[model samples]
Target chain A: MRGITITLASLLILTLISVVFANYAHGYMVFGILILAALKFIGISFCFMELKKAHSFWKVGLLLFLVLFMISVLFLAK
Target chain B: MESKILNHKNIYYPPGGILIWIIIFLELITFGIALIVMVFYGQKELEIFHTSRLQLNTTIGTINTLFLITSGYFMARSVSYLRKGQKEKSSLFLKLTMLGGLFFLGLKTIEYYFKIEAGLTVGHNTFFTFYWMLTLFHVIHVIVGLVILTSVLVGLRKNPSKVAIEDVEASAAFWHMCDLIWLLLFPVIYLLF
Candidate 1:
């Protein structure tokens, strides 16, 4: 429960940061938003999806997937 | 032998089982490709995409994200309570999760209505095309997820002890997939371009 609460709070804060600083971030806005999103994605996967209790294989696989996804998005956006 | 099988399952299968995870990965890949393609097109049709994207209601998008994330938190709580043998608490959390989903659908419907009224249909432009296609597909997933959750809730109410944790986890996994997809979709569509 505490874990989820903290995860939720972190996600909300990240979201607000993405929204609030979007204009100020200028050219780097997309990168910042995607980074925040990647963090939220990890939080949900580990806490809400209970990947923390799962085997190392699944955890590592998901992290790899996220990294690949981020690289692709950032590359394409650039 | 049974203990060995259980141990193997624990190591290989996640909370929802390997099958659901496979489906989740496939879905994520599909959406990922679509998003990348959308971004590629956005780069080419920068003007059309930017102007059309501004038609979107960022406030509504942000609210829906909150709804889905809170719903996901409720679903995680539901599964946690069920594991602790607290059926009532679990059921309550399940209902709250469903409520959050309903709120999302409601807001999305309103947003869609306004878009259609403003002639921002799928045929409107390249951006609207991707917007309608990706978001509508996601809406379908959320609807299916709600149905799965409803079934799990029914099972819990009918025979609490008989309700399997694996089943609940499977449903929760599906629900979180919706949240995950939206997490990717919202920023790209509404904020990025």
Candidate 2:
């Protein structure tokens, strides 16, 4: 219970911090920072939410899905 | 405690899971085609695409991404609490997740209003059309996921069981996938021109 409370509090803090930084970014820096914040949030979700310990199939399936998604996004961006 | 830990030695191949995967695979194909078509269209007409992108509000999209990502965490934690038989904690987290969905939807509606005010309807250009289609599709999904999660909370209150617990976990996983997809889309469509 206490740990959950601390995690939620930190999330709120991190969000505020990200928002402050996000407001100033422009051009390539914008997408770059968004990706960084995204990776950070995913890390927190996986670690604190126990998604890392989910089934191996799920983990591998998620990786495959991400790969395909990235390829499509990059294809369009080009 | 022991029973709560799902067995890793054998993964069941449920028909429902398989069916859902089929649907997801189909959607993936649709998105792939859409991406390819948009790329071709953009290659032939770059100016129109760039102008259409100016209609989007990057700040709102970024904020919504954070909102849904946090919601995914809440949904996952809700399941973890339910697994531990902490009904109140589970309900609280589920409610928080629902609020996250509401928050995203609220911001999206505001964005829609801006697009309308700027005369950026779906018919404006290919980018506008795809933007509205993709995000609104995701918005509908987040709403559906919220409904399922709310029902799970109600079930937990009425007659909780291991099956209810598993249902909540599976539903949360689906919600997380939805959230993650939006996380990827936020940058793809909104941040990048």
Model 2 residue B159 CA deviation (Å) reads: 2.3
Superposed by TM-score, candidate 2 places the C-alpha of residue B175 at a distance from the truth, in angstroms, of 1.5
Candidate 1, residue A20: the lDDT equals 70
Best by lDDT: 1
**What DockQ results do all the predictions give, each relative to the true complex?**
0.65, 0.23
Question: Where is model 1 chain B poorest over a 10-residue stretch in terms of lDDT?
Answer: B1-10
TM for candidate 1 is 0.95
| Residue-level lDDT tens digits of model 2 in B1-193 | 1134455323343211434444544654565456556656766777877667666777787688778767876876787787787888988988998899899999999999988898888888788888888877878788888888778777767766534555665677567657655755565566455
Task: Report residue A11 deviation for candidate 1 (angstroms).
Answer: 0.9
Query: Candidate 2: misplaced stretches above 4 Å?
Result: A1-51, B1-5, B8-40, B161-163
- lDDT digits (tens) for residues A1-78 of candidate 2: 455556556655655555555456654444454555456445543554444654666446645655565555555556
lDDT string for model 1 (B66-113, tens) is 999999999999988887788899999999999999999999999999
